[model samples]
Target chain A: MSARATTRPGGRSARVQQSVHQAVRDLEAEVGRDALTVPLIAARAGVTPSTVYRRWGDLRELLSDVAVERLRPDTAPADHGGLRADLEAWAAQFAEEMSSTAGRTYIRDALLGDPGQGNAVRCSDYAVEQLKAIGVRAAGRGEAVPDVETLLDVLVAPLMYRILFRPSDLSTVYTDHLVAAALGRGPATPQTKS
Target chain B: MSARATTRPGGRSARVQQSVHQAVRDLEAEVGRDALTVPLIAARAGVTPSTVYRRWGDLRELLSDVAVERLRPDTAPADHGGLRADLEAWAAQFAEEMSSTAGRTYIRDALLGDPGQGNAVRCSDYAVEQLKAIGVRAAGRGEAVPDVETLLDVLVAPLMYRILFRPSDLSTVYTDHLVAAALGRGPATPQTKS
Candidate 1:
């Protein structure tokens, strides 16, 4: 049996995990990542220092968990009957999440900190999984699915770049263009809808 | 006349400016941005700390100048006979520069350090100018130049995203695809070249 299986579902252990994770995000938003400490996180979480230390070994480990949790999409990409609609929905959702306060903090830490860290790798993998689902759906319809890397380059990466370097509202118009480009349908039309 | 016009071309002042800029890049490569300091940079450049202070006034100013110089493409996107070739060449050069040690360091500092700073703004403007040149060239060729913002979203932003988040060799095939997508030509073929 797995270690996770030992814990009862929605029990005190789960409550504590949820609280601690929330505390980490709250503290990070308040103080920024550079000034955050284990003791600070413990105090904020209403947990003991020993508990924080034993559970997470170091600040990096704890941050990685918190970051990945916040960075992951709130819901999986929906199958919207066609590849274009599915991709547009996914892109729009991804863009919205990344523009949130928690998302921005997580991304900044992931990029500026060690690139080979668990958090960075986890985030990349998470994005790939989402893209893979879209590609699979596209293939099911017999539409030519763009390679995962190209999909990332044309659609996801640009939105992410804007999130970091250029702060702007992630519009439907922009996401549609990205989707169209990825699908090899050329630039999106003005009337393209999600 | 501007303050810049007062300095004789290729004189001692120019020599000092060049040496100091080179020193900043070399120091950043050796110790990374977080560890860098004015005294150390001045020493490396063989200029007195007072001289460094008197001219640039601070580390951020000095770093900004160095970064803008390195980040700016050595030459504007050449005509290359067609819009696709010109864009491919521009993207390739941009990707190569951002992959270099100095380019990586500059970008890290720009993103992590105060996002509202002059350095980040200057770099963004530099990129816009290069994109504008390509658009103007396309217009000259009687082709539809994608809107400047779309050009950035499709062509430039993805490459910047890759340079930071994913440290792979920036492929020519990838850049050509970006250009094709920007021009509304569709996904690039395997044989796509500059």
Candidate 2:
């Protein structure tokens, strides 16, 4: 990827980046992701194709950048007075967002052409930070909170696996079971296999 | 995707498939996946490019097919006298294989350009079949067996998630915890988060 002009203070470079990104989003929604091309995005952004290429390196990298931005949580995870409630709410919401068609596309785009795995790592870091916030909240309330990795293994992994593969049965029930398992409660009724 | 010419009995078509698949494997190892093209694969397989294109639709489809075949387990899940032991052994082995660089590449190939999700579903079916075999063996020995979906969500999901995203901690200990969780054992000492 090209050296991103990300750290520059507000100026023409940042404006151009914003316009190009907005163009990608607008074109993506209108024409869909599969049909997207650099020239079209540049044309819509009112920039030359060379400008887009020099900044983002390729379409995949540009898409990955957009996906990371989209995946960033808009707010802190809600606290529900207890770790179990907190986790159930968070897991359900996370699964619902990620299982959507657009969400899935962003995830695939984030992982694609990620030669250094930086995009994937950044996405994972977002999840880790959210989980840490929940953990801190639970610890403050004196509830015995499972660690973040434990939550990741028991809760997030199953949600993602189902979303990306067997997506037919992603529901509140499944997230509830994962929360229960992570809390050391026994397998609270295994999801019925189809 | 093109309508596959997969239904005819073993004949010229089967030979063509075998040769093409072998050519893909050989060329992927030699020239690397990114360097490959239909023309290169066709030339190596002693068939015309149109033959490959007609049968497989495109390079991504052909790669997906090869990945699914590579992912299929060659033998039954080994019986280890008890469900926990059985799952631990199988999970560890599965994690090891899927965490390898080659295995990760195959998985990515399997999922990419999978419009109907047939390739992804076939890979999931392989895991399901293996888990079912383990469950049946455990039940035959009077050991309580977790259902296939439970095994899938708890055991296979974490392994895959870790493999694809957070791969540094994929080890026997991680697989052991997943198996124990599926067996209703409490999270076996949460993996040391990196």
Candidate 3:
């Protein structure tokens, strides 16, 4: 992101940018992602079509800008003083985010390279990187296995897999199980060291 | 799934069915999955257009039947007694199957619901069900955690996500990561923990 990313050519003020952004967002809510056109975005923004095109080359570029703008740092999981709590909170939150209506829609459409935009992969990569960091944190604390990254995925991937591909019901029990598994406690009660 | 699934009304043997399937497979291999079509399939089958329509209704239906027909139950992940060994063998085999030229094209197109076939979702559902059974086996003698299913997703989703979305080197390392995660082993390590 260059400093000039959001700024218009003629020194447009923050106020004007906000107006345009708000209009784009309003159109997104009404028409969903597929129906969003530059003309419509301009009309909603109360600007000329030329202005919209000048600001962004195409719809894909505009969407990409929105993703970059909206990307934020993840809040760290609470210090549960134990790997289980930290991991459980992280897995549940990860599952919830991926399963959200918007998340699923973004992911589903993104998989197809629709509109020639690359936001889906970018966003998912960002999340995966964050999860890796969290795994590293847990490992550093000695509360988790050394290969916490792989362990974390094992503990969390089911929710994401089901969220994107399967029909598994996401429940509180599921969240707990994910937590337990991350802590080296098996998902099911075993007779111990078979 | 019936005997009639093969052969034409005009005394054509099931060999025609196999030939048509082989044609679809060849066309897919040559032109890639994104380019598969009804006419091409018929041409490959060495039959008149009417033959295909009568047998499978539309291109979508034809493709659906082809997909079902190609799915060899014995060819999927094997049952190797233990979760880790089974998953290791399965992941290696499954990855090879999916990453192959034909496998990639088919799964990618299937996900896109190409040919307008409604059975795409069903195919994905069936694979996930198979995955769930694999997960159940991972539980081995343990039964305490209920979200074991989500764990399954976490392990598998990343593999699909990486394969479908990114153009990175699909090395044995990534496969091992996915296989280990799916089996509830620590990250980056082959299924070390039982």
Candidate 4:
């Protein structure tokens, strides 16, 4: 038996992995996390159950992999020429992603699972990376970048809290306040309706 | 049959309700929400399955009732003679509650369950009430209270986000920063390590 499988791009193994990952996402979106099963995923992926077991070990492991992939920002943060603009754009994008069904399901599963699973850590790291990207852009434009941890505490954390706990639409106004608070602009004043 | 059930406190109906609610909490703490079952709850409460069905109709309704009860802060917000002090004390106490096993379990269940279930709203309302109490006290002392919505958006929301996402203990410094941010004091500077 050969010690290594095919190394070429778009090979059988690569195709199998892609299909399986897509299957997990589709099934999760359709039926939710609890209803997901190894056999169902394998069937959906057009692979054998043994293949799934050999590759990922179990449902939880497979789900964790999918989570890590999905939790990552879909695109690079846009450089908006200023710290406040960059931060607000990033936050607005993040809040939009989190409000989606797919995003919410992935986050909820990771959080509801065991903390030792490292899913939360992956999610946190993803946020940190996005923040770092924004910070780098700000520094390039000769701006004093705010502390990442402080930004997380003030802006990102509150946005996420509203997303998960309050179940409201992520308003641009809300994201703007978060940026202002992080920059020491003060608490976001509420807009009164005319 | 009479039009009304007994209105006396600690009557049979009251006893059954208390026992069932306690059973839900105990089971959730031990086995978690996913493992919870109506029959299991009935057995733990020492009530019949029929009684469980007749009283609450289903597991979700029972859980919602329990959630409403548990999410309410047990004690009133302390009147610490100042807005900042009162806010910090309240945040500290809330953070402590959220750090415990029971508190985390309750929050996780509420978040993971259906959003339309009203558990999250009850929890948010609890925080709002606590903030209102502090605001009233601040006004009594001739101190200008920050906008209630602003306080919720900054202080309460971020504290909750930290509780759910990050596994770290809530520090006094973090709570102080939230209060400061709400009061337009500035970004809370990190405390120096001893």
Evaluate every candidate with DockQ and list the scores.
0.34, 0.56, 0.26, 0.46
Model 1 lDDT per residue over B1-194, tens place: 00011123687788889878778777877997678899998899899999988988788667756655665555567778777788888888787777676577667656555445456656666788888898888899897767777777777787786676665556887777778777776565343221
True contacts kept of each: 0.37, 0.45, 0.34, 0.55
Worst 10 residues of 3 chain B by lDDT: B1-10
Give the per-residue lDDT digits (tens) of candidate 1, residues A1-43: 0001112378766766776777776776698767889888888
Ranking 2 against 4 by DockQ, winner: 2
Best by TM-score: 2
lDDT values of the candidates? 0.71, 0.80, 0.57, 0.74
lDDT of model 2, residue A141: 90
Per-residue alpha-carbon lDDT of candidate 2 for residues B1-194, written as tens digits (9 for 90 to 100): 11122333688988998889889888987998889999999999999999999999999899988887888887788877788888889888888888777788878888875767788888889899999998888888888888788787788887887776674576777778778778777664465544
> TM-score of model 1 relative to the true fold?
0.71
Stronger candidate by DockQ (1 vs 3)? 1
Q: Against the true structure, what is model 4's DockQ?
A: 0.46
TM-score of chain B of 1: 0.70
Q: CA shift at A150, candidate 3, in angstroms?
A: 1.2
lDDT tens readout by residue for model 2, A1-194: 11122344688888888788788888988998889999999999999999999998999899888887778787799988888888889988898888887788877777775756788778778788999999999999998888777777788888777776675566777778778888887574465534
Residue ranges of candidate 1 with Cα displaced over 4 Å: A1-23, A29-35, A42-65, A141-144, A186-194, B1-35, B38-69, B141-143, B186-194
Runs of candidate 3 exceeding 4 Å displacement: A1-24, A42-82, A114-121, A132-148, A187-194, B1-87, B114-121, B128-155, B165-194
Docking class of 1: acceptable
Order the candidate numbers by DockQ, best to worst. Answer: 2, 4, 1, 3
